[model samples]
Target: MQATRTEEKTAETHGGASSPQPQQRLRDKKVGDLIAGKKRLVEVPYTASLADTINTLVANRIMAVAVAAPPGQWIGAGGSMILESDKQTGAVRKHYIGMVTMLDVLAHIAGNDVAPAVEGGGGGGGELERKMQVPVSTIIGHCLESLSLWTLNYNTSILDCMEVFSKGIHRALVPVDGHLENVGGVELMESASSYHMVTQMDLIKFLKVHEAELRGILTRRVRELGGLTDIVFGVTDKTNVIDAIKCMNSASLHAVPIVESTDEIGDDHGQLVNGKDRKLVGTFSATDLRGCPISQLQSCLHMNIVDFLEKLLDTPQQEACGLRTSTREHITCQPESLLREVVDKAINSHVHRVWVVDGRGLLAGLVSLADIIRMMRVWMLSEPA
Candidate 1:
């Protein structure tokens, strides 16, 4: 029930003594300071139309767009697991509010389940379709109820924020000055409203810059981090771009790996002997969609994903298709690789996730920037940043 507990606790504990200026005694500095540097929180009102939501996210190319899920209307995600009902009585678990992503917009546009139908069943499906084009607030009450919202205090440490993200929550909101902006159902403070969004990407950038200072954590192996998992989402190169986007949209992913087939994850393509299948070759992202003829993008949900990637890659074959210009490439690392190595590769390449390959060079899991920063087991690292 206490969504803003962290902020409230900090204010109560640091009352009067809390300086507006950064805390100097920590020597290394706190995550709170890092968050303070971010300048705005990108948000859309709960009343915003689905098209508006897509524009807000795609235009900003951000991980999350805040929905105005204010206190009472939404619960904050990822804090102490046992901090409920007082362990004095025994811990009571609670489900945190969920967050929204581009997937929501894409799904709505494509007619995918955005969460069970809001309100009562419609007498006429046509009327419901007509209503969807109207303001989102008509159905936002139900929509926000189903979302995961993470709330943290500006004073929360980097370590804690990492834990919050590690729990599978993509983004978070930190309460600053009390003047609130009613962004849909979510509330925001006026101080620096837009910068309130805290994503794993932001945290990764921080780690990259402080790599040396944080070597103890960075030196750990990727495989040792429990967060690393297999390439769970992918598709054959033949799947059309539209279907691929649907998959990505449903899973709320930025990109999906392109492979030969769902054939078990081994590089032993030699078994096919006379077969002409390509190996685990290239991957594509939503960003790649930008390279396609601008018009195609607006209508590309049903287009071939291969054609889209090809258009972006602009291969000799694609050039024959009238593609005049373009750009792109791939990057990956091994499970045994150190976090620092993955960190360097991702930073240098300006990519989001590094494919984790097996000893046989087969695709395994990915070391995503979000997953990298969210690997909180490293919090126990011996060295201090």
Candidate 2:
């Protein structure tokens, strides 16, 4: 009789911004300014087939490719690296290159072929040809918003890098400082085992080691559990109810980890977070909470934010949830639970976290849609980046 609140709210908020504009001070920043020099970039031949290139890149889920060399020189390299002849050619070569990404591959597949555009008469016509040879440096930071241009320098920090990635848009290029073309040390994947190869053996070993102390305490052990680390979710301390809606669209992940400055609370330097160098702050997981607003959740949900954030903040292990919350009380289990369980938790609960716990209330590793998909043996899919 209330006209279905979710549908009514969607109708009310569908078209545009909910609030009036605030003319805030804007920071002049580019992707180059945030380059942490951390991401491993692969250089492929300019003439590499789109299909082959996409296969390699999407297989690893890498963000981008530095298109270098031509079709001829790429034969021996097999679509990995490129070579340069001159020391002074570094700046010259870097600007001449175009980076390819999953978004780029999608764009290419969608038929926005920059190639035909550069060769002259194709839809956009003369403009594509004019822009083809234009220096990458010139267009690197040109933020037309729709174009999604950004830049990053070489010395940026990892936190800064994650911040850039959280923006949830495809960037054209990230140029480094001092005109360096090739940056080493950021290895995307070392070997097959180093990349996508995970087995039940590894999970069993990890579970055994962690749950060793509780061997006699817990009822049963879980074997063959694994998930993707990249698919993380969190909430923010900076956000209130209004801001929460804004951050939801900021990243691909379904949850947002909430954190506050430990320094502000005068807590010990790092007593809580496994003695890590970083501060011990709170975490909000979609598994722990959901996409619902804190106010609405408080009224309907059983637990509170402090209780929810505490679960993810604990030491990250299979049964980490047991350290704080009694898993038996909160978690619901169906013996018939499938991979879809993870997705259901994220969607129904509005959180991106799902955990595996045995009868005794000990922890098992968390699971997510990304994790379930990755572990799907029967599916034809690409590897994680």
Candidate 3:
């Protein structure tokens, strides 16, 4: 009897572990599925000037473009990343090098090439010569097919789609054949803040209203708003990490607001720090949650209110995160917190921006470190007056 009982117990344990595998297998069964795809390639001429290329990058808001020889010459290569463009010839004197990111630009500006001029010349007069560039085709991985991922049909259930995204890709480029040669569809990652997925009719209406209002406000200051909050296209804190990410891609916003509840400042505790009061206990800025585990977020939601508030006290600033100004503390106010306070804080604490909040403690606007310098310039100009 004892021998029989042991065998049964072992079998139960084995069965339990095996159950999830079948589910995962079922979920992953459609590896052969295919969908629509599109080719979004940027090819830069070898002789193209760096200024023109950078201009293209700036205009298109794209990080990198393919670098190819002029016309039909695929055998030879020049560079991958194109940095400087010549004003006179309009030929881009790009680096015959590797990949380049916004970080490269920031590093060049902050490092030995400090005060590199952004205007004029290809590599002659400006700070353009210091940067490195490369050809896009050479660096585009080992396989052309690898550049894109196969996507499921649009009719696939959202849960199934979510499973694909959870497998760790921001978006998938669907192809017509089981091959990536023919591009067809785009399956956007699911986002927690996205109201589109919510079937509830009333919630959708509320989101539309809120979005319209936010858009109206954004129209006034797209360029002026430098921080991530300034460009957050989606808002939701109640969602799992996957949901928030999906909203980011769908909204095409650089920043996404992770709020407990969009209807009010705070209502849901799922993403909020404190579940007790209907207040913004904490905020999950994109920068704050980047590369963090979703499991940790649950604990963050349950943290003490004071600790949550304390997290906000530190500057969302970094030594070299991006071009957007970062602040050590939230300090923007009416008439602006005395210019002296702004200057002193920036210099002493190494902060790059000072956020202005209203009486309700909600973020109102911001002032950049550059803005402070500009103010000083204005002061110097007024000295003679």
Candidate 4:
């Protein structure tokens, strides 16, 4: 995406035919510039049912969507949909409540309160349907508060967005400047002029496009960069899918490593034995639930996570029908690997995080999109004189 205003301003400031340094251009780039080329925002009302919300996410092929307050509560009666501002006094009106993601849905389904109902055999399908009918607002309570929706002003700098994402905020909403429109007593966000969702992937893609200018930072090894940690959370290969989901939900993790361990001596928390030698076998993620039918998911919950993944990947039905499933093989990087390699693996594999391994192929830590962005922010701020 081109940064029209920022580019024009930069070109004007530097003499014609000469461009500003890449670092200066990136620092001056604003959230509005990044979002200017993005598609219109997708949103769901707070009162929308969980089933509707799930359908919307699948239909849009998006992992999350902004949840907004009901119509009249957030906007006034006008035939134009605009930013949350009063037409007369120009005061702000808070419209968006938060974001509801696929993880939230998985957490709700795998929560302690709902697990028993799901495991109870009699009329379980009906119960699952009932749970799906609950309003989307109910799902927000099960999500990590840190993952809640954040807003950024259009003029906010790209560096500021990197800071936020570095702190584990997955996505932020950028409200486009526009007028509020009401149609037949219902406020509607105009397709051409609505909020744009900025994600870590967007920033990563931007970095990739500008990688030529970032050779110095990209060539550095992950170990030398110092973001890698020894602490890693994962589950044993024998862990049940339901228990794995619970562990991830409680920890607010997008994905967890599945390790092979012979020692079963541990609390039945479905986690790997701490301080034991384990080999990275696979992974289970909240994104695995994408496009999964509720009926199919309920049945798979009781299966072993590794078995479930194998079935998901090797099932003839999926392969024959050409269905999209979370079939990505586990991706890993070493501490000695270049940062650019990690970034390329994440973007090319279309995965959120990459596992870090020692020379023995044992789990060490993980590098997420957030971690990469954090490193970039550090590099930008610590550029040598």
Candidate 5:
């Protein structure tokens, strides 16, 4: 028979030993100690066609690819021979000139004046149909200059990597030697990679797996977590559709939260959107720009954001976006919510950043998967060595 409470109490009275606690492995793990299975190098050549670039991105399930061009050249990519290290400092030159994403490709085509209308379809034949013919060099213009791409190296610590991810930035590039060298006198040569990719998604996956084993994780609220620095750039619902898009492009943002605007918004920079009782209403993403009417593409710039979203929601599949009409409410979280809950919400919703609101439901800030991971690193660092 199982011991009764009386017996257990007696044992405790007699000074019975407490059960041993489980050992922690997550605290010791470093980004440099990234799981052997995940550290892979995938890149495309500068000369690769736009069609091939899309195919490569789809095949690898990656969002962006590095452009490999020669040193002193303006462009570079993943696995390109252009990246080389300074022998004295072992730092690779910033030959990494550009990164191309599907969103960038899609946005460029949709915004292109030359993009012809499809006879029966709402937009061009398809999003990438006509643009695929163009070379990447021509199609992907000014992206490298626009995107504030962060850098990483093979030896980057998980704690340090967390700093970059803490921002809403989704990806980072790791520069390698791009030369084959013997590994500790081994016969075979290993390629010194020019570039590799690390994403916020990767960091989130790492945390979810070990969530159960971590102590005080669920008990702690996000309000207490540190290093959350996703710079929340917002747009008023009254802002011009084109102007909102420009804000996103200039900041290289994936999504801009929509807050209530007090005044009429347009290209006029004098319009200052004062946030008083206003709060986040919705969001607009690059995905929203896909499948827009090719004819109305130019006019959409002047269309009010609220009007755009209403029109978009009415026929998203056939019109200005992919955001589902069914998903009218954007996913959000409270600052007082548990950290563990935030992680679960992000994973389940598959959202990169969760909007953090205050008690009155005002937009306080945001927490990304990177922010959570950064906190985990902080927690790890806080543990006894």
Candidate 6:
């Protein structure tokens, strides 16, 4: 996506040689602009079972979804009545209790009590099935670490939205075409209305579209940026899928890097030590379980991570689940790589993160969408007022 080409097309249409400055144009853009023509928000009722919630996420190919409470439940929520769009019925009002992500589901499944049930023989499968039938509301508590869904006005500036995402909130709800009310000087949605879900990827894509204006920052090396996390959580190829999920839940991560097992045994918590020497093999993420049948989830969980990822990629349903075709191959970059390279890889590959490796392809660190957004936020703030 070339901003220059877009500008040229605009120039041709208007017959104007000059237009607003790029930075000023970006600043003037609002959250509404980002979601102008996006599909209506997809939400699951709070009463929906965990299995149903997983179905919705897989069917929609989304990592997270808004969980809505039935109408009239917002009375004492301390805010205006927010509404959500229903595909079957138009204009249904509901209170969005919070957002639920794939990680949350994994966390719930990998909880201490549930792990043993799934790992145990005989009645384990029955226990897992029973747990899957539980209400999705039971898992909302796991979302606390990732923060609850934040509501933003459609008229909010893109920069403001970026600031919110920079704080580690993966997604936010932006009410569109809704009346706003002032509640103690804070703008709140006043009535039932539709909204668009804005994610960190949206902001990254926005930046990618305007890369021409961010050449200075993009040209720098990843090492030059200060937010890269050196401490990475991962599992070995020999680790069971269940243990991998457990590792992700324990570390509060959406994905975990898979490396070749070392002779030195790690601790009981499944955390890999000596991260610098670990060889990058593949990644296991929450999304990998998409399209998996609830009946087979237990069996899948018991398979080796390496074998499971391979079979997952080879399945005909993998494409529908949104797994990249090149998933079998490691998508990675080095610390010396330019930031632009990492951003392009992330956006192009449709992956949330790119594992950073050394010259020998050993796990070095990790760069996430949050890290990229934070870099952009820092750069934006350092600009002249």
> Each model's TM-score?
0.62, 0.25, 0.28, 0.79, 0.63, 0.83
The lDDT of each candidate is 0.52, 0.33, 0.33, 0.71, 0.58, 0.74
Model 6 spans with C-alpha error above 4 angstroms: 1-24, 72-92, 112-123, 145-147, 178-192, 265-269, 272-274, 325-327
- Report how far off residue 327 is in candidate 4 (Å): 7.0
Poorly placed runs, candidate 2 (over 4 Å): 1-40, 58-63, 69-91, 94-97, 107-149, 157-163, 169-385
Q: What's the lDDT for residue 193 in model 6?
A: 54
Candidate numbers sorted by TM-score from highest down:
6, 4, 5, 1, 3, 2
Q: Estimate the Cα RMSD of every predicted model relative to the unseen true structure.
A: 12.6, 25.2, 24.7, 7.5, 10.0, 5.8
Candidate 5 colliding pairs: 66-77, 66-78, 67-76, 67-77, 68-76, 68-77, 69-76, 178-192, 242-301
Give me candidate 2's TM-score against the actual structure: 0.25
Q: How would you encode candidate 5's per-residue C-alpha lDDT over 1-385 as one tens digit per residue?
A: 3657656776686577344335647654555444335645566666777767766664554566766544565533322333545656756553544577756765565354333344465454453455565666564444433244445555555556666576455676554532322111111112233445667877777767877655566569887775344356677766766566556655566666777654443424313233323477876765554435443554454567767767766553432222332225766778778887788877775566788776776677788776777677667677776
Better candidate by lDDT, 3 or 6:
6
Q: What range of 10 consecutive residues in model 2 has the weakest lDDT sum?
A: 189-198
Query: Tens digits of per-residue lDDT for model 3 on 20-87?
Result: 22322222223232121223434456555443455455444344444434322333222222223344
Candidate with the greatest TM-score versus the true structure: 6
- Identify the leading candidate in terms of lDDT: 6
lDDT tens digits by residue: candidate 6, 214-245: 78789999998875778876788778877878
Higher-scoring candidate on lDDT, 1 or 6: 6
lDDT tens digits, residue span 109-185, model 4: 77643432344464355656777899887677466842344556676677777888787777766667633321111
Error of 3 at 215 (Å): 37
